[model samples]
Target: MNELISQAIAQWQLMHSIELVATLLALAYVILALQQSLWCWPAALLSTVLFTHVMWQSALLSDALLQLYYAGMALYGWWRWQQLKQGSAGSRGPVYEWPWQRHCWLIMATAVAGLALGAVMANYTHAEFAYLDAQTTVFSVMATWLVARKLVSNWLYWVVIDAVSIYVYAQKHLYFLTGLFMLYTVIAIAGYFIWRSHYQQQPAVRLSV
Candidate 1:
């Protein structure tokens, strides 16, 4: 019993230690991204690198994998944003909104995929809140892509995802992340308005991607 207790305490300390630094970097990523700063990608890359290990240790496989994806997207986002800034893409500005039809299809597809993944994990593995985790992971994947693509509506997607993430992290006793997601939810709302304003100032350019 003493041995188990000691192990648990050590794990808790380690998790919190990592979470603290990851949270700070993640905060930096969000703030910089809000400002359309290219530096956000490097911050996101480092933060997700730490989160991948943390989520894997917590048995959140979907989230762990998502962190890996985020790391890759961070690099891609930086390159793409740099191109946008340089006017290499022939675009007026960095932000654009997807049509309602596209958003509808995206939501339907994401829901189906999330359900399928959740069912597989629930039956074949020991994952906590399998459906919720899978759904959030799927939506986050889409949101992150939209962010990289500089979609104005990405912030709206993140607003919903971050709010849901608060409950998910809380269930795992990751109090720091729970608080971070709470902050994220608020920031995402502000981001939507800020990006929308920027988008409105530009000549509308729609490109199918």
Candidate 2:
């Protein structure tokens, strides 16, 4: 057990600084998004760009495409957040609750979208692990959309995605990043419950204003 743990530690310690920086930015985005902060989209976009280059350089073509998708989502999310802003109240910006139903629909839609992307990737690009790649990308797109919409269940998708990402990263010897995703799993679970509880107390309202 000690040997195994030591090996894991050494492997992680050998990870490059660039990858470490990308993970930090990713985590920062998640934490900010969880707090319902509008800055999450832009911050997350920075991480996406960094990771895109990293993945492309590492020849993880599918992952590079995923980051490009994330870039697009970030733009949409930024716009969505602008709509959510209720203007500054004194010093702080106003915020509002989101309906849980939106999250449900988003998840369902993502599954369908993933199937379509998988078909295209399998037919055209030299995308390795085509189906799995498309699925993760699509799920992430949906999850990001939910976050942008201020939906409470966005973290639920993260919980699932992060779990899978950990194994995938480990298989590729990205031990440090695998550990980062593992840590994110705990945060995602906590965020899910916290946001759910908050959602429960919201009064009936059509719009978030």
How do all models score by TM-score? 0.93, 0.77
- Per-residue CA lDDT of model 2 for 1-209, tens digit only, reads 99999997875554456688888888888788767677888888898887887677655576788899888888988887776565433221333455568557766888888888888878887766677767887887667666766666678888999898887778777665788899899999988887776666554435442
lDDT of 1: 0.90
Give stretches of model 1 more than 4 Å off. 1-7, 88-93
**Whole-model lDDT, model 2:** 0.74
Span of ten consecutive residues with least summed lDDT in model 1: 87-96
lDDT by residue (97-116, candidate 1, tens digit) is 88899999999999999999
- Our model 1 lands, by Cα RMSD against the true structure, at 2.1
For candidate 1, list the clashing residue pairs, or say none: none
Candidate 2: worst-modelled 10 consecutive residues by lDDT? 87-96
Q: Residue 114: error of model 1 in Å?
A: 0.5
lDDT of 1 at 126: 84
On the 0 to 100 scale, the lDDT of residue 176 in model 2 is 59
